[model samples]
Every structure is written in C-alpha cells, then in structure tokens.
Target: MELPTALYLPGDDGGFTATPLTIGPWDVTLQHAGPPAALLLREAERVSGIEGGQTVRLAYDICGPVPVGPVRVRGSVVRPGRRVELVETVLEVGERPLMRLSAWRMRTRADDPAAAVARDAEPHPAPLEPAGSRPEVPAFFTTDVAYHRALEWRFAEGSFNAPGPATAWTRTRSELVAGEPMTPLQHLLVMTDAASGISAALDWNTATFANVDLGVALHRPPRGEWLGMAARTVLGGTGAAQCFAVLFDEAGPIGRSSQSLFVEPRAQA
Candidate 1:
C-alpha cells in the first residue's frame, strides 16, 4: 500500500484523519501509540491561553486502541497559570476516548552561562552512526505496515532482532501533520513509544509487551530531526513490565522516558 504523505491530515469539524503511517506492528487497523501521543502533545501545545510556555513534562495515557480513521481532538488548559500550566488533550473516536495527554508547560528564562549547572550530568556521548540501515523489521510486523517505513532507524548498539537493551537513532520521513513542519518535541514523542519494541527483554515470538502509558520528562528541548534512545525493558514475575530510555539528541542527554507495559504470552496462531 502507498503510505500517506503524513501521519495525520486535518479535517473539518476540528477533527483529524489518521493515515496508514499511524498503523502499528500489533494491528493493521489500529494506530500506534507513538503518533497519537505526538498528536496529543501537538494539540495540547495549541490550546488557548498557554502561549510562550514550553512543555517540560508529558504524560500520555492510552485508554484504548486508537483506530486509523477520523478522530476528534479536543484541548483545554485545565490548570492555568502565569509561569506554569497544565494542558490536557484527548483523542476520541466518536464518544470513546482513545488517549489523553496531560502536559506541564512552563516559562523559562533565557539561557545564561552563570545559571547553567549539571552541564556534565550524564556523560553519554552519542554513539557512532550505524554502518547501514537495519535490514529487517521485527518478525511481528508485516512488511506492508507504514509506521516502520515512515521512520528511518539506525541502531548504534543492538538491533530489532537482537534481544536485550538497545540504543538506536530515529527520525520520521513524513510530516506529523500535512503541510505543517513537526516541532522538535513532536519528533521526540513520535519515536518515544518504540523504546520497548527495540529493547525487548522477552522473546517477541513468545511474549507480548504493550505499553499502557508513557511518561516523559525533559530539562531541555531536543534539537534537530534525529533522536536517539538507549532503552531497556524490565519485566516482573507478575506479568508487569516497564521500559525506560535515556533520550538524547546529537548534543547529548536531553531527557528520560518510561512506559508502563502489560505483558502476556503471545497467542499461538
């Protein structure tokens, strides 16, 4: 199938149409959490009364599977403030809510050399570029899925097929929304949810790990198009798991992201 030009296209009645690029590896009909999470933050940033603030924290809760179709996006300033504010955005298919994002936007002073601290906090320098493009997608993904195709992946440490922790760099080929350029935050959010899939601790052929929520905290905004993540997944005995990643740009460590995952055995075909 020919991929859409963008992940989402604006529609009438304050809605957006999710394109094939939003489809995930788990289901062809359902949209991936990454695109929708970015959409939520995109809409939250556009909420009235919150101009000039930068989102420092983003908490996205996946209420249900977001379908690849028309979706209503609504945003509001739940807790308005002069320096700090809470913005909420919800994506709904008809009356059913698919996801909600609560973002904390804050005002920041101009960069000051004297005010700078923790400049050498985590000395995780960006890894050397991968030798070549990843040759194959995870076995669980169909060859026709557009989401994986929409983003370019280059692994610095482990690969899609390799188990255990992996560090990879990723950037989207398509725009987040048609005609409008995606912001740095949008680019980061669009690839954040894949931390679990790339750094799987369990065998994909045997177990499935789906994240229920994603939380991200950033001390500074990301720069450039490519974002890197050094991620790992930790599974508990009780079928609960968490994926954590130290987010990075070419400069260095920018933030961290964590995902709460629900793990179970993959059903036999």
Candidate 2:
C-alpha cells in the first residue's frame, strides 16, 4: 500500500502543487484540512525565519472546499519579530482561495529548575499494542491511500467507526511533501485536524461533522516520531460542535488542539 500523507507536488515555477493524497472528510475529490494545514505550517515556519523557536499557536480557516490537484501556495510574514512572529499561507486553485492559515512562532526559553520541580504530572499512558491490521471502514470514508496505511495508529481507547471519544497513538510513516522533510510541528499538525475522525461523537452513516476551522497550541516543542491523541467531540443543539485533542509524544504532554465543527446531516453529492 502507498502512503497517503505526501500530497505536495513539486511545481516547475518553484512552488508546490496539491495532489490527491490530500483528500479529506467530505469526499475523495477534496483535500483534507490536515495535509493543507501541515503544508501551510511548513511554509509559515520557513518564511518566519525564527530558528530555534517553536510554533505556539496555529489557526486555519477553511474558506471553501479545497479542491484536489495543482493548487498554488504562497507564504508571507505578517508580523515579524524576534520573540514572536506571525506568518500566513494561502492555498488557491486558480484565482479562488480555498484555505488561509496563520501561525505564531515564539522563541524558546531556558526552563526554570524550580518550576520544573514544583508541579506534579501523570505518567504517560502505557504503550499501545501492535495494531495487526487496519480495521474495516465504510467505503465512502476510505480513500485511495488510506489513513491507516500512512500513519501507524495504535488505538488504546476508541475506534474509527465507533461513535465516542478516543485515545490513540499515531506515528507518521509517510512524508508530508514528496521530497521535502517534515518537521516535528508539521508531523503533529498533520493529525490535528483529524480530531473529528479520531473521536467521532456522531454516526458516520447518518451525520456529518465538518470542521471549518482548526486552532492548535503547543506548550513545548514535541520530540520523537510517535504522537498520542486523546480526542473527544462535544455537540450542541445549535448545529455546532467542537473536537478537542490533547496531544502527546513519548516524553510527556506537548500541547492541545481545537476544531470548530459544523455538524449536520451528510449531504448527497
């Protein structure tokens, strides 16, 4: 099986193009919020020019359905500074803008020894067991390069098809761009937008939960390739919901992510 994560095509004009591997929730023809979000983050980090700093927060707005194939990407520094830098990246198909993303990069600081000793913390969850085979999922939800094939998912608390909160360990076995190196932040961000799928509170056969926006905040730079997510979806009566994922790596708690979801019945294509 081929990897599903690498979706950026090298462009002749020194830019990158979108590929079908970016496909997401709505359908196969559209790209997922995670891949584009990761792509934007990659560019943001590049343009920010703040080396040794970490991404403190990332906010992405899905302006419309991000179509598959050959979308253009542009990254720029909106507010530049030494301690804090704001960067933005936009993905467009022709003249139509599909998604816009902004990120805040902050400088790293030496930790206070006293602060480290003052707080008590829980131990990391037990390592997940080997996931022998990919679980069976509905055909409508499956893509040409399935998520299971791209990422090594060792589920500890919940399942993809089940309707409830979930906790799982995810490690990237695939690349974000074909030949480009994916940073730790990019790796984490690639799965941030999948909180809805990791923990679906709604039925897949009858309902839809489309996240229009994603907000991610990291307390410290993540280490190791494996990332863990404890995600849940909370729905309200006003046709809105939220998917929150507490992120982790082998070391300890790293950060958290939030997605503003537009919950509704699945619309026929």
Candidate 3:
C-alpha cells in the first residue's frame, strides 16, 4: 500500500508510522520509525507490569534500506527487570534480514543518591528561542526532521557547507502524552540522535561517513529546557570515521554519544 505523504512527516504521532524504504547495497532507511520504538519498548515494560519510569535505550542497525521491500518487525526480551529491560528487534525482508534494532529500558534513578549538600548548578542552554522551521533537505540528510511534528529543531551551527561537527538545540513541541509530565532523560532522547557525525563540503554538496555504527549513552538525565548537543567528528579514515559528542541539558553535562562513520555524497553517479 502506498503510504500518505503526510504520514511521513515528523512528530510524535507522525513518528509512529514509518514506511521502510530501500536503497543501495544492504541499506534501508527507516522513515517515521524512531519514536514508535519508544512506545513499543514502553509497552513491553507495561506488559511485564514493571513499575517506575523505565529508562528506554535504543540502538538500531540498518543492514539495507528496509523501505522498498516487504518487511516484518519482531521483538523479544534478552533480559527483563523491574528497573531495566533489554529487547531486540529485526526488520526482515521475507526471511532475509534487512535491519536489526536493540534496546535497553530502565527506570530512572537519582543521579546522586549519596549526596546531601548537592552542588547542583544549572547548565540550561538558554530558553528555547524558537529558531523556527524544519529542514527540507534530501532523505540522505540524517538530521532532517521534516517528517517529525512533535519535535522541532533550530541549528546553533548549520551543517550546510560547514566542516567539522554540528551543534543544535532541540525540544518537544507537544505536552505530556498522559499529562503526567516527561522526565529530563525522555527529553534527552528526543534530541540526541538528530545530528549525524559528518559535515558537508561545498565541492560536492555532500557529506558522507562510511561504515556508520552509532549510539548515544546518557549518564545524567536532562532537567528540562532546550537540550544542547555539541557534536563533532573525532576521527576519520579511508571510507570510515568515528565521532564523539557531549550532551548538555543546560544544568550540566547530561551524557555523551559516539558513532562510527562512513562519509559519502548525495549525488553519487
């Protein structure tokens, strides 16, 4: 069935409906497909009947563009707990595996339980100033949020024709799903994955990072406000690269993210 163009738009609701797309050698783009995994992991937590706010961590691998072929999603538990749960999913193309995603869901815990006189100093990234408008770049642009509605982005440093890493401040546009309020860690996940590891060069109008395998790990949960991502490529090599990033929620450092990269161009012949 042909998916609606609007359905592909980004947002919390929009993210729930992803249409898999196929391209290149062993590559598939998962469209409007991220946040639903959030809901899915949460559901698994509920079905297990666990208590407390479980921290859900997700990591995905794109074997190929799962978009163009017949795909199926199946998930299972690796380790289950009231505080943490591990699960994995595979997007298979008629028995041939196309992509796999793994996740860890855990309930939130205080960053410091032993401290009494906390040296709590806030590192807020300025109030969200509404930088405005989602991007309309090609699908190859990994950070494009044109498909998302619930989350809007404003780039502190635009990736267009820029070298080095990119920085952006992002926040949620919608209120709490159940009106119970979302935690800082939940906010961190919303913006953590927007920026990829490579930068575009003017010569080819393309930024390619080959052999890209990446993940974001948050040590301290964000405490509301605009979460800032100071992202940059740490190293690169022949057909490959790696990046390191520090995440800030304005109160202090929330956590960090690192990814393996494979740089390439958009208009490849």
lDDT of 1 by residue, 1-269 (tens): 56677899999777899888888877788888899999898889888465667789999999999888899889999999988998999999999988999999998779766534565555764566534434345566764756787677888788788789988888778889899887888989988999999999888788888999999999888888778899999988799999999998876788899999999998979
Question: What is the overall TM-score of model 2 with all chains considered together?
Answer: 0.89
Give the best candidate by lDDT. 1
List where candidate 3 sits over 4 angstroms from the true fold.
1-16, 19-49, 68-72, 92-97, 107-119, 122-145, 148-150, 157-161, 173-190, 197-204, 223-225, 265-269
lDDT value, candidate 1, whole model = 0.84
- From the highest TM-score down, the ranking of the candidates is 1, 2, 3
lDDT measured at residue 266 in model 3 versus the true structure, 0 to 100: 48
Q: Per-residue alpha-carbon lDDT of model 2 for 59-141, expressed as tens digits?
A: 89999987777777788989989888888989788888788998888888897677555422645542453353233433445
Candidate 1 positional error at 26, Å:
1.0
Q: Per lDDT, what order, best first? A: 1, 2, 3
lDDT, residue 93, candidate 1? 97
TM-scores, all models, native as reference: 0.93, 0.89, 0.62
Give a tens-digit lDDT track for model 3, residues 40-124.
3333444443466544355656564335323345667777777777777665556766556566766766656443124255443
